[model samples]
Target: MKNSEEFDDSFMDNEKVVLQSIAEDLRTCLPVEAMLPSESLAVEKAQQNCKPTVHVDAFLYDEEAVDLLCEEGKMSRDYCLLCGSHRTAPLGFISHSFSALELRFLFQNVLPDLSGKMLVDVGSRLGAVLYGGCLYSSAAQLVGVEISAEFAKLQRMVMEKYDFTDRIQVIHADICTQTSLLQNADVVVMNNVFEYFLESSEQMRAWHCISQNVRKKGALLVTVPSVQEALAALQGKNGVINIHEWLEELPLDYDVYLGKDTDPESFKQIHLYRVL
Candidate 1:
């Protein structure tokens, strides 16, 4: 037990160092103007307009009090692996921070042209994508589709907080099944939300909807957690998983750009698909 305690302390120390390094990198890469306004505003909007979390356990856990020490390579049993919560609700500060990094990467590398075109963010949560779009591009229309009414209202509120309501629109609809509602868009983004649909058929349908909705030459930016992470969860541990085979299974309408992080197990792996 003494040896185990020492090992745990060392592991936590190493984790802290890595996290600090990442935080520095992010601070350097992401612009100051690209971040969310304030936590008070976000929390207030969530509390007032978003779904009542009092009822949903499908994606909620009192992480402050909950002690579920996930073993090395083991899944976090306290939260939903797909949505990162036991309940289907808005994201927290940590999740938003990670997402902002990915968004910075997207803005810098993936879709450089954000000016004068309509951009659609399927499953946009609390206007994060809209904020990214507004920061990165001068796109005429930044439309966001969210299935959860609570979330849609919160996104609307968030847009108002940024005074971007006139430019960004949040619709209450599911993009997967309601393809007709999604008109042709120049850029369509689905960040870290694709893996939620565990069924292959559902994934295929989502692709179809995205393909049909996007312009012929438009760009599609989607993020999937590293295969290693997915495997680790199932095996009660985490590691990096290759997406080569996974890309092959996706629709042939677009050529997917695979992103490889220096550390594969960091959940930083991303894939970008541009529709042909």
Candidate 2:
């Protein structure tokens, strides 16, 4: 990343405008809901197993997008019970991918400069992080491992549409099979990958596979909700992976502001670790 202080305010503003434009263009390429038929399993799992309240995917629709949906009368921030009675509560939303602001925060704030680094996004749905990295960092390679063939096809299409083929590559395969690539990665990002999508047993398997391979000394591992929080549920099935010995948790400065589209709580969920 270049020194933000060196650039004039207008230049920084223009940079953000460019990224926002890309996000808008990407939105036009997909369905309004942004949940494709290819993601039926994930959508079903989210509906049945996620929290008791309404669950909204945060990847495709950020806070700003949600507000627009509310304006169109298609979605609501709060649902009224008893046929539009006054009693209502805010909706619970969840997402598997980073928003554009979050991605900007990631590339500009959390992670170090990636002038010649190779970063991999596990379960890289919609290639949001890849595009953000392409815009914010000078990473040599931004690889995405996605299990769904259709989603992978979508990612490739976007890459081709925006001429990002040189920097980003989408591989339609489960992340467990990419041991060598993980080993070679300078940075690996996992955004609440398996909790909702996989059963307890499958989560254990994927976590085990990740622990064994992404162990290059000093490699960075970024996870939403922290590694300990994510892996705690897998306790009984996951005696093989010990995070304290394998990775060291690093504190992040969530005090920094990314943009108006991002909230403070959103920044707190992101946790960074260093491979030991």
Candidate 3:
């Protein structure tokens, strides 16, 4: 095996191929409308028992390919039964899953070692982080906690299809309810979990809950937006929860993962923190 310092573009290229093959298999059963959580039986069944019946695409880096699989036209609207008023859209109204490249950067650079460790992805929609961990690290266990049952089912289906059941598991429960899981995780990844998916009150409660439960000292906490930025957004807001008390900033040395084709500035938004 090559040392971490010896990693290069050749390794990235090979990993990309493996990742793309998995994505291509998922794309077959995952239509655009089905990308978001849905209660449709057809979509659920298709995802639950998906098989790779077609050849994997040679190039899976194009986000447009995924978008093209979606249903065309405006999304359907919902109305309240009592007052006939419009209600808020579904949980996945906005897509929050990380791109393949971002996942690569995170596992290869931000977290280069995961031997015998357990990783948990909060709000693990579409299981992007979980899949990336399996491919890029030697973590003993990879778990995804998704509140959406539909999304959880999709994740399990994909895992089953890829025969990763030994290392990957998806729990269909809210992250707040899984405090024990959080407490025991060696690495916890929260990718835009609170920004759009949660309400202000829920976000505050979640931060509080996490601070109290995720008490494993020195555990890694990865977030997309820097901790400062996340807190600054709630500076003047009422009922803001301070997470800095429980987490301390950890500087990341990610230069080793950068190459001519990769821009260091692109990852400025990525933040790493350690449990205090």
Q: lDDT of model 3 at residue 244? A: 66
TM match of model 3 to true structure = 0.72
Candidate 3: lDDT of 48? 40
Q: How accurate is candidate 1 locally (lDDT)?
A: 0.48
lDDT (CA) per prediction: 0.48, 0.81, 0.69
Q: Once all C-alphas are superposed, what RMSD does model 3 give against the true structure? A: 10.3
TM-score of 2: 0.88
List, residue by residue over 130-167, the lDDT tens digit for candidate 3. Answer: 98899888999999999888778878988988788999
Best by lDDT: 2
Candidate 1 vs candidate 2, lDDT winner:
2
Tens digit of per-residue lDDT, candidate 2, span 158-275: 7887789999999999898999999999999999788867888888999998899999999999998788888887877857578999999887887775433447678889999999
- lDDT by residue for model 1 (1-276), tens: 433544544443332343333333333433322223322433343345333221111111123212331343222333333555456434222233234334445565556576777788777755566766666567888898876676677567556655787789988876876565455676666654444323334444565555455534545545454333433343322322233322322222222221221122222355555554
Error of 2 at 28 (Å): 3.4
TM-score of each: 0.49, 0.88, 0.72
Every model: Cα RMSD to truth: 14.5, 3.7, 10.3
- Show the lowest summed lDDT stretch of 10 residues, model 1: 53-62
